[model samples]
Target: MENQVFESSEERTFQYQSSLPSLPVPALDESLKKYLDAVKPFLNHKEYQRTEDIVKKFEHGIGKVLHHKLLERAKVKKNWLEEWWLNVAYLDARIPTQIYYNFGGPGPYLEHYWPPKEGTQIERGCIAIWHTLKYWELIRTEKVIVHRYGNMPLDMSQFRMIFCTCKIPGIPRDSLSNYFRTESEGECPSHLIVLCRGRVFAFDAVHEGHILSPPEIFRQLAYIQKRCHNEPDGPGLAALTSGERTQWAEIREYLTNLDPKNLSLLEKIQSSLFVISLDDSSPNGTPEDYTPITKLSLTGDPTIRWGDKSYNCIIFSNGTFGSNCDTFVADLSPCKRLLGQDLTLI
Candidate 1:
């Protein structure tokens, strides 16, 4: 095989998107058979028989109609699962999205160059945020090396959603808000949202056409951390975003009706670039192992997590980092890969 070169990274990255095979709609009978086989462990003989009969009916009757409709829809769309997945797996799910649907992991930084250091959490956090902004810039500029599978480029479309994006709760469904843009595309929001002690603050991450210097980020983060320590606790309204969908919708409605100012506050939260969680817990780990960092990030204070946001950098008091994100795709390697690479940059 000879090495291949490209004039533009975008061309190489998106080369396979149009040629990639479409998502196949499985045959109803085959899928039903697999379902019955999967359920055999949970059901007794008679229960299995009853389920088999029910499955038979579904496969032949209304199930056929539904499958036909799905196939019809697939004929019109390149990927049928896109919208249905958003609806069923995310929007329509009644469970709390943070614990139920979100994916989280500890920063791979501790495993590499930067280890836990007392009193440097904010400093290190700013560094991580800076690298993350750089990663965002890479995505915005189509500079990320194209991921390939067996000589073909995989889809890099979701990179666009990695920053300046959030899920907006609504009645019966939720929608995504993405404000990210490249320099050539147009203006995009360049601010960062800091979450501390249930209160939120905003500051521009991009200062004078560049990501803020580590010192500037340090000052901004220090101010928020100090205010959080001195002031009485905020409403911690972000906790509501972790609630079940319908419950959140109702609570959101009540909140909206309660005060006009609340609506603006919610908008500010849902539209920010990303969230930085200033955690009070000191989840420590040894030099070689960092598993506890991830465990703590997912199980830590619920009030501090904005689960619907695309990214939440959970920074512990000891300068360790873990993260929670509303990534829904099966392949979550992109996030972990990006964060892992960014952890060692500064």
Candidate 2:
């Protein structure tokens, strides 16, 4: 479905949030029956019968109590399992997020006019950045249309993490840092971060109360690229994000303590709208053969990618594009869909 922007006072993107139904807790009996069905293939007749007996016992005893507690929780919370799911599935994982937990894919433009063309990286990247900022504006103004399943509108809260969000590491578990806010809610971060040649640069996407046009963004990107080519590389602090979660957390804390300014710099990256990675490698692969591109996008340059950021747009030297993003923010499908629509804007 095509996304429509609604500028009228009566319509807004998140209008359905309040009216949407809360997530429900399934019955214990239903869950137990599904568990039995799942285990049947793995167990023989005797083993299956013994496992079934244990499951039935639990279903009648502690399972009923836990289910009742969950039902009580659902009564108070809109989505009872959201925080638990995020923690268990993402934040608490100790593996390197870059190649393991994060998701990436080949650029959507590969099937169309934009292909691997050397020296076009900054120019095409500026256009993509401009459209991405426009998408941010649509969300800020509440003009973007709400997504629906049939007549029912789905929750749009996760859209906030699409911009101005980062995942911060901790000792026991990581945490999400989100600075997104609609115009009616409050002010939000409008700065952009560019990662090139192991150096980090920040600039305001909104200048003089308006988002910069493609030409303006191109000037900024071109300047960063040129400086990166001319000068010595800055410390690749971003590579820390590719390490194990607890290790990254300790290193980040050490850096912060080494210099108070380091904490400010970290905040800048965490609060920026999103990251634009200017990659030097060009994985020249067509849409029909995306293996090369996908591999590089997910695992190529640790120095150039902030593995924990909610979104990172990777612009290769040949003008091809790919994205590496933390799954904790949102899944790849919706981001891909949004990028597809953003390309139409371009």
Candidate 3:
């Protein structure tokens, strides 16, 4: 018989897609199962399904809520998982344990969120504006002071310090180690010192500091919340405490309309100070050999450090830092002269 090509009907027309394999459901603990059973009427099978199926369902539901424009914009052309991989990489560098929160004041009262046991001491870079001004004397004396405020403080003193203990890579060794190992000023690590109210200060393990003033930090936080639409309680719950909610709401509303350009200016200054090490060396004499310790975004800000001096270099969307790259270049150009060398503009 002559050789002949053959096609099946199945190949010509697509059949209904096969259902994905049913994921195994873990056996719930007795207490959890009982509780789930009690609430079965309200949640139906969706709440008591296999974890994999539940995750898929949740993803599908979220897809429905996303705006079509946003979905289109977020879609990856290639290597779609790159963002997830990057997120994983970032999370891996974070400290596994939580730090104790101590509100600054006469009483070293611990906050509700303080971990039961101190895990590894993580370095939180830089001192806040308020800490520099309000607690400068105390920080200088004690080397460590607990912040009464929660999270980052709001203040204007953009002076920031880099320390050795943070979970993040590339930070210098602990200040205590530098202090004990070397008395020579040359051996001393470049310190991020805040000079406020005629006082100089640094944060120790027990104390904390921020890069912004209280009002400024608050404004930034408000701006972030407004942009992200975050809420302390789950979304759509308006029954929470009115006083506190109203206060934050007002701040958030005000900041929503405010220009972010000025805020970016302060962040740039502080970020720059964080990466520079005064103790490091520059070919010109002033330390110009500083490498950026933090990964900076072209759209956001870049933290650059040389020796003991660091600064946040802001890059505009156009790949220019600020009005013009030359503007910043001109400002930093003088530092080369401080290195005892005359250099021509690039």
Candidate 4:
């Protein structure tokens, strides 16, 4: 077997640099004012003052750093600061103005906070905000808006919103609480709208029939790890344990002999392999239900051959559907060799 290689620091830097495009002066429009008004109430809410202050402070510091970097990049040209202002205006028009925190339950309970329920498209606003914040340096802003809404079925008593000295719109009056429903799936149409440079964008807490969050993904990962431990002769394991033997002991022994870093690689490969098999056997032929599986492989150098024909392997990732024959056909190549057979026999 050949050793797997990782990219070098210079290679990684080059890749990162290649992905970024040259900064362009984006247009500012009246829609930005509308977006600001839409998100004002949440930003100015008393509950979120502290968080808002902190974020503003961070943004200010980051903006200063970016200004210096950009100035140097442009050879200290006059009016270079104007470029930064344009970037900031562009971002302000797109990003949200508040961040909502969950306030449900007695002790330490927090729910998923989405956007406002009415008068705006929440998903679009959220994505715009995300993009602005992510590219803040390139698109500078003194203050950024982040609309926060509590998760459904969860109480909003502890919910908090953070913002600067911005006023929220009152005309399209609506509460963040009223937008989302407690349904198990589908988009909430009445969610808050995000206006960016006069263009409207929307976002929904519901994605692919479920809500998105970091904790949810972490829980799923833990479940998969536990299942892997309990099942003796599991997909990757070649043996089983009895009453006198503990599975943990076998795992420990295996770890001792293998490189620690390879463990992650092995897990990734094993998880992907499992998804491929599971998808192939599914009655509905869809992998959306398998959220824990991240990647799948259908064909590779490791081919399985039967008689005169060779079958290629298939691969997939989470959020991917096996029914998409176009993706499979486009990604995979035909296998020309056979497994458990002599190459000359073909």
Candidate 1, residues 1-346: lDDT per residue as tens digits? Answer: 3224233544534446578777899988889989998999999999999999999898889999999999998899989989877887787777788888898878746545777777988889988988888777766666666766777666766767878888877778887888777666788877777778877777777655777778778888887788778978777777888888888889888887988877876766776788889988887766666668877778778778888899989998988889999965230242221121101000
Minimal lDDT window, size 10, model 1: 337-346
Q: How high is the CA lDDT of each candidate model?
A: 0.76, 0.84, 0.24, 0.24
Candidate 2 yields a Cα-based lDDT of 0.84
Model 3 bad stretches (over 4 Å): 1-46, 49-140, 143-188, 191-273, 276-298, 301-346
Clashing pairs in 2: none
* Collision pairs in model 1: none
| Candidate number with greatest TM-score | 2
Model 4: per-residue lDDT, tens digit, 272-338? 1011111211111222332221112222111110000011112111112221110101101112110
lDDT of each residue in 1-346, candidate 2, tens digit only: 4345555466788888988899989888888889989989999999999998899899889888898899999999999999899999998999987778999977656557897899999889999989899989988888777877777777878888899999999989999888999999988998888888888887778876699889888888887888889988877778989999999999989988988877888888899999989999988878688887788889988988999888889999999888999997760342231121110000
**Structural similarity to truth (TM-score) of each candidate:** 0.80, 0.92, 0.20, 0.21
**Candidate 1 segments whose C-alpha is farther than 4 A from its true place:** 1-21, 27-66, 287-291, 329-346
By the TM-score metric, which is better: model 1 or model 3?
1
Q: Which candidate, 2 or 4, has the higher lDDT?
A: 2
Task: Sort all candidates by lDDT, best to worst.
Answer: 2, 1, 4, 3
Best candidate per lDDT, number?
2
Which is superior by lDDT, 2 or 3?
Answer: 2
Residue-level lDDT for 303 in candidate 2: 85
RMSD of each: 7.6, 7.0, 25.6, 24.9
Q: Give the TM-score of candidate 4.
A: 0.21
